[model samples]
Target: MSTYLPVSGWCYMTNDLMKEIIRVAVEAGERIMKIYEGDIRIEHKEDSSPLTEADRRSHEHIVSELKKITPEIPVLSEESADISWQKRKSWGKYWLVDPLDGTKEFIKKNGEFTVNIALIKENALAAGVVVIPAQKLIYRADINNGAFRRNYDGAETKLTADNNLNTDNLKIVGSRSHQSELMQTFVSNFENYEIVAAGSSLKFCLLAEGKADVYPRFGPTSEWDTAAGQCVLECAGGVVLDNAGNKLQYNTKDSVLNPYFIGMREYNEAVLSWFKALN
Candidate 1:
């Protein structure tokens, strides 16, 4: 609903939206870890998704801080995003966020939950930040600039991937929590790739870090679920596309549920052709 990215306040690249997002998430994580440390009851939404007080706390904290820090930019958060397509279609730039990305892991107390934040422009994810609240680690990227991981030692390391990421052992990324039979068949179909399982938005982080190559998701996912991760993944030299091999767009469709998709590193015509053949 806004066109202020060009004339906006913060310089997205140098301004460190990553830092801001991480800061907010870490602050929210403080609250989440508090409840998580206790015997808090986890509730389930209508879709049977596990919900908890941590989710609401994180959502409220993220939304409040994002609005105050980057008030000029429109935001779509998984918890409170309801802007109509008519209004969002007019937007050239907006923030796509998932305040609590892994509620299931939160319920499972596996410490795999994360915070996801991304900026979108012209249907492309421009920048993203993913933070694991439990471990207090972060991975961030601004498109074409570079991707970075901030470990527990507070050291920031730049991420790099070999050009032949798809060639070697052929790392395949799949959801650590939820996996479908079809998804398994798809992975089983690939003889050259080694399958690896991960949870939450961290699957995309694996692709971003060159730890994995291909991520195929057959189940339903919301736009907020993948937007932030896709930004970091693509920035780190990867591609996340629908079965049609098209870049995923946010807020353009009436249903927020995303179709099946794949995440591949060093993408090219051959990979695109393979994806096309699957469709």
Candidate 2:
């Protein structure tokens, strides 16, 4: 892989490479849409999560294309077989992919599902691409460069999160399909707030585009599910922090399950207090 130094002094992915990553994710979304329009046969994995042909097809296509794009870098997908920690612990960087996020939304035909792909460098997000196939919206970001969103018609716009946001009337984004008691409690603490129920990584995209102020996730999610979105949100002047107010990291342990996290344009003392209380 080639290295490029940005003004941030971070040797990260270049704009051209990020563009290629977005292309791969968009292509995978095209594959997913094909199966989504069909009978939509579903299966269950060992964990009992719903699985569909779209997930498998998208995973295969993403892994193959990423390998061809950078054969030196390893790729990990939600559908891939578990690799031993002994082998993966030493990996400095890799591709983390969730071919089909929001399977529940897909099954419900709500057009909230998405395709996610991220590049992880030493457990930190280096670059990411999130494609909402149903919404015809695409988002991509890298650590050094800023974030951007592209429409289906080929028009692209730069994304900038609102750092100087008003916390009085918070626009909170939550899951449309998945909900939890903890999440309910977190929201209840806020006297003045509006909730936007969305599915998939669109929660993060909402924050990146300044449409939403905060997103608190208390349920289970894999690294692949959040890594891509984290990159986009953070690059857009936002942050995704764990309960401890620390930024989320990937591939530091054997398990892929991620800790509870809050996605926000900027850290709010009131919001962090609520998250800390829950923890």
Candidate 3:
């Protein structure tokens, strides 16, 4: 049965709705995997980021499913992101999707890519679902509902970020593809920390599952790239703060590019200070 919580005027987050979103993400992942197992043709966008058939197929599947599930809600996908700001600025709630988050990782066949879906209400993350197609795992969260991780065999584990504030032995997750000089400088501030290199939104899931302590993203990312992961991490007792030390928001401006941010299990004055110093 579907249960809903009226979070704001005319906005609701329902358990059944979340389930449907997850299903959409999973089905999209299946489509991507089929292409992943075959000849992967690559293309480039205006920004030169790699694109593949898997990306387009997954985008089509997810967008189609989401529209069928909730015809009223709008959808903004990385593949079909040409929607004008004037058209999107008025959307009180919509689906923010990144059909293929780690195309590079997928091209490398590293099995670290994922399909991301998030619900944005009033420019805030209201719900999210991330499906790791290669690994057959899913992470999900919603407003007022705790986060959870579903395994391949239908097992689910409630996720909670590790509250360990031990900066001496912090496990910082970093991007496998986009590395920056600022990231190295930021890590130099840590006396004893190890880097957990990962691709796509799995970095956020690592924090949500208590597998990693923090994720500092010093490179470029879009709103769709982090919205679903941010919701999962935040719901699991974590936080994703922009350089300005505010929660990362969605669809706030004309450009979809997001500010550099940090995802951590809990608030740490030391980490925040370090980030501020670098910025």
Candidate 4:
């Protein structure tokens, strides 16, 4: 297999490097599982969200491996101490990571959490990988390169987002942790939709693979929460657009919080029209 991919106007990343990222993600997942399967201790951050040993182990392992792989590229991880915007704004290319994306799901043992890693080039997502630790599934993609899914059995399949607009039975994915009345009201616009409650970046992965049609997140999400999954989904022909129908961009502002957005396999005119009316 070739190690190099030509990405004009951006630093090229080798296939070997991508594979190493996948390997690192899997190893982090293993570390998370070891903590998941044992007696667990939980702590809380300033935000009052649950933090466990699994999250710390995974974060430490992933950050260490990424630094080893690309020491020149700075990393912004969920577990890392917050860097000042002045420093972050100076970075031309860097890694955005959430070592354990769904800590709530991890604590609940629902097997829905994921490890997210994204390459950000000049405020745009360049490449990404999402790892489902419990399932041993890995999804990845890069700019101009198509998306793929690797199953637990080691079989790989190219991924594509569903382009058909079937209004009769729309499948909408909603957040398991951050559900709110506003989101429910937004989802009510779909007349014949079924809500699929999901956690973390897996919602985007599901849309990328045609398992779900749309995901509307009206609640809070940081840049690291969505950047990796966005790359995979976008490469698979999906779109993650904010309420204004603009593509979700990263690192454009000092704050890492993301605006409410929808992940869609195919653009639905009716939904957008309604979304515009409401927003």
Q: Which predicted model would earn the best lDDT?
A: 3
Candidate No. with top TM-score: 3
Using all chains and alpha carbons, the TM-scores for the candidates as numbered come to 0.88, 0.93, 0.94, 0.93
Residues 107-226, model 2: lDDT tens digits: 999999989998888889988899999888899888777889988678888899956767778888976555578888888887798889888898999999899999988888999999
Error of 3 at 217 (Å): 1.0
Give, for candidate 3, the lowest lDDT window spanning 10 residues: 1-10
Instruction: Identify the superior model by lDDT, candidate 1 or candidate 3.
Output: 3
Residue pairs with clashing backbones, model 3: none
Ranking by lDDT: 3, 2, 4, 1
Q: Each candidate: what lDDT?
A: 0.77, 0.86, 0.88, 0.85
* Candidate 1: segments with Cα more than 4 A from true spot: 1-11, 166-168, 175-179, 268-274
Candidate 3 lands at a TM-score of: 0.94
RMSD of each: 3.6, 3.1, 2.7, 2.8
Model 3, stretches more than 4 Å misplaced? Answer: 1-11, 176-179
Tell me which of candidates 3 and 4 scores higher on lDDT: 3
Which should have the higher TM-score, number 1 or number 4?
Answer: 4
**Candidate 3 per-residue lDDT over residues 1-279, each given as its tens digit:** 223223344325676677778878888999999999988999999999999999999999888887777877889999999999999999989999999999999999999999999989999988899999999999999868779999756888899885776899999898655568889899999899888988999999999988888898888899999999998999899999999899899889999999989999988978987987777
lDDT of candidate 1 over 167-254, digit per residue (tens): 5367877665556766665655556777687788988888888888878777779999998788778777787888887887777777
Give me the runs in candidate 4 sitting further than 4 Å from their true place.
1-11, 175-179
Candidate 1 RMSD to the real structure: 3.6
